[model samples]
Target: MDREFRYTQKDFNRARAFLLQLTGIKLADSKDSLVYSRLVPRLRKLQLEDVRRYVDYLEQHPEEEEHFINALTTNLTSFFREPHHFDILSEFIQRGEVVNRVWCAASSTGEEPYSIAMTLVNVAGGFASSAQVIASDIDSNVLRHASDGIYPLEKVNPLNNKKLFFKRGVGVNAGKARVCAQLRKLLEFQKINLLDEEYPVKAGLDVIFCRNVMIYFDKDTQEKILLKLLSKLRTGGLYIAGHSENFSHFSHLMKPIGRTAYIKL
Candidate 1:
């Protein structure tokens, strides 16, 4: 098959290796097409000859690394995705747990963390709750977008307290809504590379929602990140994993409490 730009096995291998080294994310052999589709735009933007040139440009121009990672990293998310997790959180709060400090480890476009803030607010009956949510991601671009707290109506409409939590846009801004100041205030966004030597987040968090992120890593990288994340979560605190992410292998560190959710031991 002919593509607009030159893409070879070597290019894919080099790019995937760099990505793994920089982010602890492993790309499978089947991801060549995926890589091409995700990266062609970057090549066009940089006016590069091919994927090989893009890889060389990445190494030569360190500033290009961010754009490269942003291009490849998946940011598929929706407001209140996996509603059951929020239900579990409500139950935890009702059961007399004071969940004050929470972390959303991969807060793609801010939906997950914002959903968390909404849940905490609902449980506490207002914005006066002591809960604070720290939302972080590896992509700087997505972090900025998440910090804005603006989304299309399609994403914002289904939220039960949409009116209370978000303000509708009108005129040129129609069909969009921005999270209310009260809702936005509950969260702080930061750029965090899971592969970092030391996680900059504070220790002793009450809950951690690191869902769906471990799937990108290999076994050893996953275990390394999980251990670091667990150190930040207090014992008996809730640690939520993605639906497909099973932590049963780490039973000694955490125990499954609900669907793909864990309790730090």
Candidate 2:
């Protein structure tokens, strides 16, 4: 059957408001096209007339909020994506710095955290036995997938020489790979909303990979989250963000190294 399409302005407004209220992710008027495009499949699957009905159903059923959040949040990521950051991390580990604990604060679908795990395994050459990876995401659905340590084979394509970090599977799981048991053993996945007033973990981390998450928040919100993240980072530890993000305004708390990496001074 052909999918029906009907997205009115009122529907767009309702979805935008509902999403912002629930997740603090602001979807602007200009994003109407994007909103419609992303949610249309959901509407078709649910057999809803348009976006407004979908919003109403979501509001009435609080349990489905997670589904809405997962549908809307962009979780694009890759292993070793910005390889230079891992290079820096390997160098820091080579210097024998205290880095037993690392947090991938915005580890979407496990890529970033898994990438970190692979890097540790390579540099430490079995030294990761003493290390741990805390990988958190706001979306619980994605967190579940991350915890499973499974990914489509294509996602591991960017690992370069790090293919040994994963184990291939076939049959029902064909075209997929799971993080090596050793790497999976070191990773712990949790659901954490970055906008929360207090984060759960109090351990002072030696490094944090919060890349690509702050680009969605406003400047003040970005600073607030960054401050909270910095509080958990040990002195002289590092923080990395998306390549497009800048820390010129935060120079007082963090010193910019090269690229988008920062050191907490």
Candidate 3:
């Protein structure tokens, strides 16, 4: 929908600066149109006349910050979106002698953590019965959906062990599935901003699946985040990244042990 609002270069700059200041996402100049398109709905919803006015409203109303962040943040995730990582996770569990604590640092819409939970459940008997998974994200909106554990039937069809982890809906709830209570019990969904200096998780996490979200940050922010994630991981623990994220430059903190997977050294 074309916004009945004016979106000027100055306004775009202001919006970009605001997003960066709040979310640590540095938008490229080319993203001006993208930002305009994304925020136009916000302006319409708030009955604001222009991007400049929306900025003013945001500055005045700090409570709207969550809505602003939610509006711009992208939440594209699915169960077992990256299958190879799950394979690596399974291997790690098989070789481990102790119980593992896993954290899905950017658990957008809960798919990655759910996938991790499925793997954990598969190996629970032989690997370790005490394994736990924590799924977290900065966006409260997606976390709510993740916590609900409801997904469209088509979106979850690709999961490898469908019958084991999901219950397909029938009758009035047809064409959807709810994550079975057994699998859902393994995950604790919460809100977590990566830019924060400290996380609430305990030390010595055995696995941290922080996929796809790092591409949004610049090199400096990426390094800072890497350090924080590494600190939370135990020695010989694993840190999984998105296939597109190349952290080879930070060899001091972690070394690549598999495709887009690293071991805390």
Candidate 4:
């Protein structure tokens, strides 16, 4: 069959439904162009001219689901993406009110969790001695990269010549920075799907960095996840989200003390 290169409204609807079923990301009709733009590379890579054929191939090959998810998911994150949250975290640690197990719920590619580790190391005084950073993501591929603890120099641009926390190297694998063994020792990366059952952590966390991840879920799912996170948060713990995300709906459960940052009451 000659693959249909051009996408129609039907194709857009089908793709949207498939993605929604697979990842719960709602793609509105207006996003048809965006979907086409993102999926075109996948089509080209597979050498398939038709979107329908690509969809069919995906249905038969379940393992390729992750590739589709990675292609569609927007992972715009950075070390200390929102600096104020880290400031709040530093303050929380100074209060000395709880255990220091920090969970970076959507630790895409490790920057956020690593940033948390660096902040705690810088400001926690003796608290860093006991602090543990757990970084988790649903995407195994990104989690592997995070666990490796190596990043392109550009990715760590926010470090701002702070060579104390990282070691710069140049050889056959030149132009890359790696987290020093001391810093990497403080981090643990795992593959976690938040949409599944409430995550089980061995210890109650002092801070939950669920940043920028809840925006993808529907209102009900967001509330459900928020409640689950709250359950794991020790009293006086902090829960941080993306700048664009708010817990106004769950204001009863969390007290907002700063911009996009919340404290469990």
How do these models rank on TM-score, best leading? 1, 3, 2, 4
RMSD per prediction, one decimal? 1.0, 2.4, 2.0, 2.9
What TM-score, to 2 decimals, does candidate 3 have? Answer: 0.94
Ordering by lDDT: 1, 3, 2, 4
Candidate 3: Cα lDDT at 152 = 91
TM-scores for every candidate against the unseen true structure:
0.97, 0.91, 0.94, 0.88
Q: After superposing candidate 2, which stretches have Cα over 4 Å from the reference?
A: 1-5, 44-47, 157-163
Q: Each candidate's lDDT (Cα)? A: 0.92, 0.83, 0.86, 0.80
Model 3 per-residue lDDT at 112? 84
Best by TM-score: 1
lDDT of 4 by residue, 62-167 (tens): 9878888777777778787888988888887677655468899879888898889888888855234667899988777688878888888887766743586777
Q: Which ten residues in a row have the lowest lDDT in candidate 4?
A: 122-131
| Candidate 4 runs further than 4 Å off | 1-4, 125-128, 155-161
- Per-residue alpha-carbon lDDT of candidate 3 for residues 1-265, written as tens digits (9 for 90 to 100): 5556888889989988888888888888988788888888888899988889999999999998898888888789877887999989888878863446899988988888888888888877423356678999888999998999989988888767788778999999899999998778778877889999999889999899999989999989988988898899998898999989988987887889889998888
Candidate 1 C-alpha lDDT tens digits along 1-265: 7899999999999999999988888999999999999999999999999999999999999899999899889898877788999999999889988899999999999999999999999999998986799999999989999999889999988779889999999999899999999889899988999899799888999999999889999988898899999999999899998988888999998988899888899
TM-score of 1: 0.97
Query: Which ten-residue region of model 3 has the weakest summed lDDT?
Result: 123-132
Which residue pairs collide in model 1, if any?
A: none
